[model samples]
Target: MLRITTLLLILVAISSCSNKKTETEPLTAEHKAKIVGLSKDLIKSINDFDFSIVNSTWSNKAFKDRVSNITGTQKSVFEHIFEKDLKRKIKTGNLSIIHHINSTNGAASFFNLDHKDHHSELTILLTYNDNFNFFKYRIEIENQKPVLSDSYNFRDNLWYSEKIINSLRLASKHNAFSNDRRETNIAIHNSDQELLKGDTLEALYYLYDIPTTHQTGNWLSFRKLTLAQSLSDSVYASVMVTEYENNKSLYMKYLYHLYFSDSTDLEKVYDILSEELGESKTLDSLVSSGSFWD
Candidate 1:
């Protein structure tokens, strides 16, 4: 929590600093100082365990709506960790706000709080409004890397954002043998290679069993087999994505989709990757659905 005098001193310095600058139409220090103050108040309320203040402060933010969509189990978690952290008492010092302004939508603030632990928290967010000021805003204590990396991606028939799914790891697991295994196997059978192909209907049964504790000891996933099946039929027209041995390189690892006529005769097509993988956005479950990693 920030001391009352510390916040005042910081605000005064910002106000004085603004007086010396010739500003343009972009965000001004004076305007940002107000936002910082408001953000500080919210933090203050949270530290004091004053739910009313914390809740009422963001009356015009998108986070409030997102909070409403949180499930009961999710709520229980926040009450345990997030709520406790949000409301814990502590002495804070050296507060600074960085304002990032843009040509399009103006800017936001990152509330930098220096604490006794020699560590600091950098929070960034904004109460962005449309042309109509409809209270459509976002106030997140932004982090470049979230708590969860991969999560359960349940999809029926829509493209879900990778940012959301990756941010929550939800109820998911990394059984290096399940998802990739099963998907590969299904693709093999679909390609029509007798030897490479496994029991398709059987693999399908264990396909979604991942992200669980149930140990269904059966063959799962098959891409090589999928290609082999294609080869057996004379024309192997399928997508193939190569995995990098060292995925930490970011650019080294990739997700590929390809089609081929035979093992030797092939058409290299449809490929995309980025040096930016684990960004806060998301890594969609489309990979599991055989969308691009076919």
Candidate 2:
């Protein structure tokens, strides 16, 4: 019995030690350096419009499987498509890595690539795997990109209006709208005014202020609040909004469709509001106060 007890204690100690190691072990400087070097090389390749480097940067099995699943195309055909896409990006200009976050197994790097006209910028996110191999990336374009905006000038406004209307309607169905209807009406009216004035970000905030019962999850309210707050700096809005949209949480998707749909009309009031509200406040406080609508 004594020997058995000692063995059990020893096993427990070993397990505790293993857990501590895992919990405390952070990515080493060497690992971070490796990730940074890999990221630089990948960005350089992209700027040079050399798709061949992808053959080395990407894990062959993973890339091949993903492309096959998505397009039902063989590796050669997918490479051709990828090359075309890279060429288009090259036309924009060289890409520069601006920020990165490294993890034990991988890293995510943010890049800013200038537009062809050099007037605007596009943000790209590259996600790598444990092997320091890139497996995915997302490029966010301006909503007013020539191809989409030229053909449909007012599409963004229309989309925003529709979303607000639909969300309000849903809230009503759930009896989430307040009895006074004053707040709800004000929200709709203010949003409309901002939309017409081309202050898209403020318009979104007005729509965000409509109070809903907590039981209903107030999904739209939370989503729009997050979006409005993030849009305080319109230059980084696309990247921030895209990251939230891609978040695995289903509630986060409510505002995903709002991004890259139109050019934001700059609002001077954004700075004032951001300052007044205290930019670092948690999302819950922002939603509860409803000061943004005021």
Model 2 Cα displacement at 18 (Å)? Answer: 2.9
Alpha carbon deviation, residue 292, candidate 2 (Å)? 25
* Candidate 2 residue-wise lDDT, 259-290, digit = tens: 43321321223333334223423323433443
lDDT of 1 by residue, 149-189 (tens): 11111111111123223222342333336674455445435
In terms of TM-score, how similar is model 2 to the real structure?
0.22
Clashes per model (N, Cα, C within 3 A)? 19, 0
Give the TM-scores of the predictions, in the order they appear. Answer: 0.21, 0.22
The Cα RMSD of model 1 versus the native structure comes to: 21.2
Residue 146: error of model 2 in Å?
A: 40
Q: Tell how far residue 240 is off in model 2, in angstroms.
A: 21
